[model samples]
Target: MKLYSLMTTAVLIASTSAYYVKNQKSETFSLNVTPVDAGTQEECKTCITFAGQTINDLLQFVLQEEVDVCGDLCQIVVDKTGKEALGVICTILCDVVGIKEFINAIQKADLDPIYFCELVPACPINDNGDAHFTSLEVMPKKGPQGEFDISFEYVSNNGTGTGMLAISVDTVDGIPLGDDFLNFAQPAGTYDGTIKLDAKENPDCDPTQGPCETWEPGTYTIHLSVCNGECGSNHPHSAIYDTKTTTFEITQN
Candidate 1:
């Protein structure tokens, strides 16, 4: 219970910040939202789960203050994941998505419990017809998995250009397990599709070129973000349009 109190205090501190980042309608952050009562761990394995969304919100709120110190934290993520190319994401996520909006979304969790993935671009707040994610689901959410499929709908309200849907599979603590980038001509419409992923798909090293890291039996995070331009590691743009995410467990095969 002490852990919970410490965590809550951190969240309160973040809530009192005077800073305000603009959203779709140029609105400031608001913290009038209350967290849901997350149940026990027996029913929920990961904080990202539907029943555990409150936990996810609390985590994001607590980390909102960390953006100032993310230089060190971001390096740790890059060092562990070896994706030094996209290190800017760590800062972009925190700075772009303020804690005020997190609470606002949490109040509406009855309709949809948005995770961190949803929160980032979701953090961007789609109040102005900005592209946002919906209907995200991971197949066989739990089990001894060698393969899986991620299906979701992305609504783009912008012009047709090189839009990117970046996917990264990582551990709960931020170590990447694998990553994929879906770049396509996105116009004003909603695109829905399911991507097939295998345990053999490695993000660290390319299997086609050499040996790579395979999926292991553990809880992992699948993070997806949408942006207007090329968002590859080498290619960096200013912002992430939106995001969708889920967590799953991989058991022994």
Candidate 2:
């Protein structure tokens, strides 16, 4: 695991993360996609796709408070689908991949069940490749201000274990900050790094014009996005493969 560390102060940034929120398909979103003739790489395309989408739906249906509970949720879906076979395969793959200490890491990590099926014998890996963050660790959970550090690990399909990284921090209430981290260039492999940062009052806010911004004491979310090459702000030209967000609260010292 390659590790890099940096220290910096918080700057206000327009939260462009709204674009990443997935819009769930309508109430009647159908899971009926016909299997295409893709040779041997996708023999289980239909089953895998159906299972994967079902998993996604089950996950989304969970109440926000219980979103992280997957074991019971997943078991319910498998039972409902009448496809105990796939559940068995999932258990086998979960064990064989050793992705997490426990087999349910598949559900815990929210790994795309379809893409994960790529590990199955008949459903070969996608030729397009993949990139994602495996873990995010932070300290002083109260907030990301002075004397705070965040470490995260990521894996990508790029030949070299490097790629571009962009980070943004914002309050859940939609307060504005400065233009924070843009893009740190790296490669397309597995890498680990930490960044030390301090939260700041809105640097752009002027007291003469209005109240100088204060770092509110509440929940704030930090977003990290990685791209195969260049990352775009809007829909087109967006090659971002993975995005992860961690939330922390700010309190009076």
Candidate 3:
């Protein structure tokens, strides 16, 4: 009888705790967005004007003073706002000095419950369209243990700017076979490159012994990324214009 009573008590306590946590998560949160300076506001008027009515109103409200928001309502905000408008707002917000404060306020308010990361843009607004890879192909899709050619076509919306292209080959599980190659000061356009799969490249397998000697006999993905401008080790300013994954297979003899 005493054990039964204890179990009932524990159950009641757990239920109460869950209810409290649920209520806490549903609690309202408030954030104070810093006001934009006159010069900054003037500079961003084009973005604001292009944001349309719904996002414009939200932008105005967020730029003013402290506002109360809840996760449920913020989800609605996201549904109503366009991606481009959010990108503009993020750009403007990041340009401001108090961006960290605003981010902190958002965290404290738990607004992320409604996918806040998706609502905020990470990169600055690019008037030019983003770069993209139109097509990627590997010649001799299945090759004996030897060198292969990879060709890819890319389009840069920012005109013919100099950039860096990084390429690497790895197994499906992400085990790198050879060193990553980087090409700098390359113009934005189609590129044809060569990669070798031999004992020297992998050193783990001996392809001379059989078809799968030097490298594993399976499919591998060639990862390629083109970044704008000279990308250093950190590549902070080097925004990725395009990324592509092309697959090639090594067949057994």
Candidate 4:
């Protein structure tokens, strides 16, 4: 049942809220990460469908706003006291014994995905992974000409499928770069910001199918690859499950 056709890969960085009021003092920052081991292939087996599917029905339809796991600790508030640090913060890391980690390690765990959606779980037939950070945007500093706007969200199926959402950065010496593809169509969703970054090989996302760049900051990484490709299209055209890889991280302070 590899009827692949699922691509919800996104990375957006917004700019021009008057360019953060014209850089007040330089604390400008933006960092976002969404990765919980996406969906470990073999058709797609995100922790064997939660083994018994209970952690609130596997996050009411698989995470959208927040779900915390891994040693029990979570914080994604990039910025909250602006007098000089505009704003931006997003952090997500997973694999804490999976299956939604007993309701994301409970501490009042209820981030709201329609209040656990209905215990999520419907893409199964090989579900094809991705459940976290349905949306994220951060812009700390660097405007006046740097500009910004970024977005990310995944999980869709209308029938036919194919997926690959990507964005990357880091190469002062670390080398991990990508900046191409604001949106790659299908029955997918969410793809904003089709302007800005006019130079440096042109890439706010998807300049022709690749990760191009010109923003030299510090550390960076952003990639989202979800390929269900209409479930392999009758296995022809050099068949190969299409694609599947969900990774996240965006940093600059």
Residue 47 alpha-carbon offset, candidate 1, angstroms: 42
Candidate with top lDDT is 2
lDDT by residue (1-253, candidate 4, tens digit) is: 1212112232233321100001011111232222222232311222122221223333343454454443222222112222111111011113323436434332123432111211222123223422233444434223322444444343343421222233443344453544322111233233322112221224345646644455454433334333332222332111222232332232443
1-253 in candidate 2: lDDT tens per residue? 1111112233212122111111122111111112233443233433343444455545454433253333555465577666665455444443444433322333442544333343333343322545688976667788534444666677756431112355666764475432223222223456665654455554665678754436667777778776532344332222567889887777775
Displacement of the residue 98 alpha carbon in candidate 4, Å = 17
What Cα-based lDDT does every candidate model obtain?
0.42, 0.44, 0.39, 0.28
Model 3, residue 12: C-alpha shift (Å) = 70
Worst 10 residues of 1 by lDDT: 1-10
RMSD of each: 19.2, 16.9, 21.5, 16.9
Clashing residue pairs, backbone N/CA/C < 3 A, model 1: 119-123, 120-123
User: What are the per-residue Cα lDDT tens digits for candidate 1 across 7-89?
Assistant: 11001011211111111110111112123223321111121222122333334444574433545544544555465533444
Q: What's each prediction's TM-score?
A: 0.41, 0.40, 0.37, 0.22
Whole-model alpha-carbon lDDT for candidate 4: 0.28
Flag the better candidate by TM-score, 2 or 3: 2
Ranking by TM-score: 1, 2, 3, 4
Better of 3 and 4 by lDDT: 3
* Residues 13-55, model 3: lDDT tens digits: 1111001001011001111122223432223322222222234
